[model samples]
Target chain A: MSSPKVEIIESYCKGCSICVEFCPTDVFEMDGFLAKVVRPEACTKCMQCELRCPDFAVKVH
Target chain B: MAFDYEQYLRPGKLPHIWCPGCGHGIVMKGLIRAMDTCGLEKNNTAIVSGIGCASRLPGYVDFNTLHTAHGRAAAFATGIKMAKPEMDVLVVGGDGDGVAIGGNHFIHACRRNIDMTYVLLNNYIYGMTGGQFSPCTPVGAKASTTPYGNPDPTFDIAKLAIGAGATFVARTTAFHATQIDKLIAAGLRHKGMAIIEVLDDCPTAYGRRNKFRSVIDMMKRLKEIAVPIKAAAHMTPEQLEGKVLTGILHQEERPEYCEQYQQVIASAQGD
Candidate 1:
C-alpha cells in the first residue's frame, strides 16, 4: 500500500493545536498558528489529527 | 478518497461558527461518517436541531435540515417522522436545549420509542448563551452565571435516556473520535428510539471559567475521564471513580411509535 499523504487546509485551520497535541507519532507541528505536516513519513494514518481537528483542516489520503 | 467530507457538507458553509477547539465539530464529522456508513440518503434524511452552539450543526450538513426553537429539536423531529415515516429523522442539540428547555419533549419521545436517533452533545454549559450552567454541568463548576461555582446537581444523560424508555442508548466522549462514528452508526441502524450522548467540550465559555488553561487541556480531561464499557468491567469501583463509561449502555427491541400509529390507523379503518 502507498504511504498516506496528509494535507492541512490553511483557510480552514484555526490553530487549535488539537492535531498537533493528539498525533501519537508527532506527525505535525505548528507553523505559526496553522498546523503543518512536519513528519509526513512518520504518519501511521491513525487519523487522530484529521478526526479530532475541529476546523476540518486536516485530511489524510 | 479521503472520506470525502465536502460531499456531505453544504457548500459555502465551510468556516463553521464553532470555536477552534470546540468538540461539536468533531461530533459533526462523526455524524457525517455515521450517515455515510449507514448509507442514509441525503435527500431522505432530516437533521433537526434547537438553538445552541451545537444546534448550528444542521445548517452545515447537506440534508433535509431543520433549525428549530430552543429545546424543541426532539418535538420537531417527532413531527417530521410522524408525517413522513420513510425519512430518517435525526435530532441534535446541546445539554441545555435537550434536557433543560426541551426536557419534557425529550422524555416523551423516548417513552414513545420513536424510530429516530438523538445525538445529545453534553458540553456541560450553554456555550452559545455565554457559559450558563446546564443540566449536565458538573457540580461546583464555574460558569458565567455561576461565578461563585455552580450548586446545581447534574443529570446523567445516558441514565435519563435509559430510564425514559429509549430502546438504544450509548455514550462516548469527543476524545474517542473513532468511537463516536461507531456508536452513532449503531444508533442509526437500531429500530427504535436511539440516544447517543456525546461528552463534548466548550473551551471558550466553559473552560475559561473552569480553570482549563487551553483547549488541549480540556480535550485531555475528556480523554482521561472516559473508560470504555468493556474495560470498565475489569476495573474496580475505586479505579473507575470519576470516570465515565463509554459504549452502548442500553438496548432492547420495542414496537416503534410510527409503526404502532399505523396499527391504530388500520384498526380504526377496520382493516
Candidate 2:
C-alpha cells in the first residue's frame, strides 16, 4: 500500500485530463469540469500524473 | 521496500503541472535517478531550461534552478558553467526551445565542448503556447502548425552534436527510463560536453494529431521503431524505415573551452 497521496489544485487545473490518463492506478476522476482525486490510495506516487500535467494542477504527496 | 522520493520533492509543491500522459514525467524521473546515482550535493546542482513545455522541468525540481527565456537554456547553462566550473549543471528543454529557436546557441555549445550536460526532452512537437512544429519533428508528422502532414526534414540531434563537436552524444526515449538514467549519469561525469536526446511524447499535441490511440500506444511505437546500433548495423535499408537509433552514438576527449580559455588567460598574464 502506497501511503503517499495525490492532491489536485483545482484552481490551476484547466480540465486537461493529462494526469487522469497517465496514472496507472486511475486515482483521478472528472468532477464535472475539474480533475478530482477520487482515490488517493490508488496512487503509487509515481509522479507520472504530476509531470505529465501541462496545466501543472496535479501533485503527488 | 520504499523509495524515498520525498527527500527530493518539495512538500508544498505536491503534484506537478504537466498534462496527463505527457512523456515529461518519465524524463524527470530518469534525471532524478541519474542525479541520485551521481551522489550530487543538492546545493551544488542546478537545472536550467528555456521556454517550452519540457522547459518546465527546472521549476519542479528541488535544486538550484533557472527557467529562462525561450531557446536560451544552453546559453544560460553555458554562462553558469563558465562562472562555476565545478558545479553539476544540467540544462533541460524541448526540441523547439533547444533546436529551433535556440539552434545557433545549441550548435555553438557543442562546438565549444563546454563542460556541461544537456538533457533535451524532445517531444517532437512544441507543446507550449500551442502545438507548433519544431525543427526536430519528423517529416510527415502532423502537428498543429503542420496540419495534414509535415513536409520538412527532421533534425538528427545525436549526429548533429557529433558533427558540432560535442564530446559525448547519446539518444534515448522516455520508454528507456533506466538506460536514460545511466546515460545521463555517465554524461555528468564526462569531462567535456554531453547531450542526451530524450524522445518523449506530447500526447495532447502530437498524439491527437497523429491519430494515436493513447500515450501507451505512442510509447509502444518506440519499441517497434527504435533500433540499437548493433541491430541497426545488420538491418537493411528497407528494415530501417521509421526506426530511430538510440544509445551512445559517440564519445571522445578533446581540449574543452574552459580549459583552453584558462590557458589563454594565463598566456595573456591576466591582462
C-alpha local distance difference test of each model: 0.93, 0.82
Candidate 1 wrong stretches, greater than 4 Å: A1-3
lDDT of 2 by residue, B86-155 (tens): 7888999999998889999999999999999999988888898789888887889898888978999989
lDDT of 1 by residue, B114-209 (tens): 999999999999999888889888999999889998898889998998899999999999988899999999999999999999999898989989
DockQ of each: 0.76, 0.14
> How would you class the docking of model 1?
medium
Worst 10 residues of 2 chain B by lDDT: B1-10
Model 1 DockQ reads 0.76
TM-scores, all candidates, are 0.97, 0.83
Q: How well is candidate 2 docked (DockQ)?
A: 0.14
**Per-residue lDDT over A1-23 for candidate 2, one digit per residue giving the tens place of the 0 to 100 score:** 54986777777676656566667
How much is the lDDT of residue B158 in candidate 1? 89
